[model samples]
Target: MQLTRFTDIGLRIVMRLAVAGEQPSDTTPMTTKDLARELAVPYTHVAKVVGRLAEMGAVHSRRGRAGGLAITDLGREAQIGWLARTLEGPGEVVDCEGSQPCPLRSACRLRGALARAQRAFFDSLDEHTVADLVRDPTGAVLLSLSPPPPAPPTDDAPGNRHLPQHR
Candidate 1:
């Protein structure tokens, strides 16, 4: 699975705000600077992302000292839903080329099995809400401090393709 850094960061920001809850504490508002510091991301990068998020109405921002960032209801739901789709990739997996179908199409049990696994992957992700990520802010913070998850196995992995034996 290929998750764009944008969606990953977007979800992190949303999760943080959800953990922080609805009130931004006296309207002093949490600035991107504060968020960048907490998230260990560069200030300018977070600012740019925050701009896009604000435009999408996933985050609300104000200008000036008291102005800061907070999550809107729409932003939370939309961001989560968007992540569910894009996190997997911008494309579909089961594609057939030309008029030729895979010879295994008729007898391959693994085809449907893999499809079920793929569906489970998405369904599992969709079950989560931003609220779930915030259930334990400290734990979430600890987890994010670690590196990103390992990349999924590629076609280069062993046994990825069936091969014929040499004569």
Candidate 2:
């Protein structure tokens, strides 16, 4: 079963956060803008997914200068299947109840088979966690995408003009 774009983005976000969480120095929370830029996804889309992740207790968000987004421990340890299911919601792979309802809705073996296939897909995912998705090379790549922390002001910097000079 193909994963929806929404679930795909959500998974990417979680994986990136999990990678960051593994690196103490990289634990600085990332803003939605940063995540969007890094993932090459639209800001609005990332924002929406971030909101849902926060609701799931998989992501933590804080507002203000020092506030940003971070993956919670729950997010890092969450089973991939459970997270995917949460992101995917309760929609069938094949829409039997659309405006033009399927004529075979009442007697469709296909629907049952598709449902079983979907379950198998998720069950396979259950074997992994966000951390599992970012081991070694993958984790390194995701960590490389993180924005560097702001540089501290030096004595000669414009913002440090108020500081007393030490010869």
Q: Provide the overall lDDT of each model, using Cα atoms, as 2-decimal numbers.
A: 0.66, 0.90
Per-candidate clashes come to: 1, 0
Enumerate residue pairs that collide in model 1.
58-75
Model 2 RMSD, rounded to 1 decimal: 9.4
lDDT of 1 by residue, 1-167 (tens): 44557667777777776555344443456678877777877788788778877877778999986688888887556535555554334444564333887777767777677667766666677776676556665545633443345579887779776666679
State the lDDT of candidate 2 residue by residue for 1-167, as single tens digits.
88889999999999988876566776567889989988888899999999999999999999999999888999999999999999999988899999999999999999999999999999999999998888888989998884555578788898777877689
List RMSD in Å for every model shown. Answer: 14.9, 9.4
Best lDDT goes to which candidate? Answer: 2
- Provide the lDDT at 106 for model 1: 69
User: For model 2, which pairs clash?
Assistant: none
Worst window of 10 by summed lDDT in candidate 2: 19-28
TM-score of each: 0.56, 0.82
Model 1 vs truth, CA RMSD: 14.9
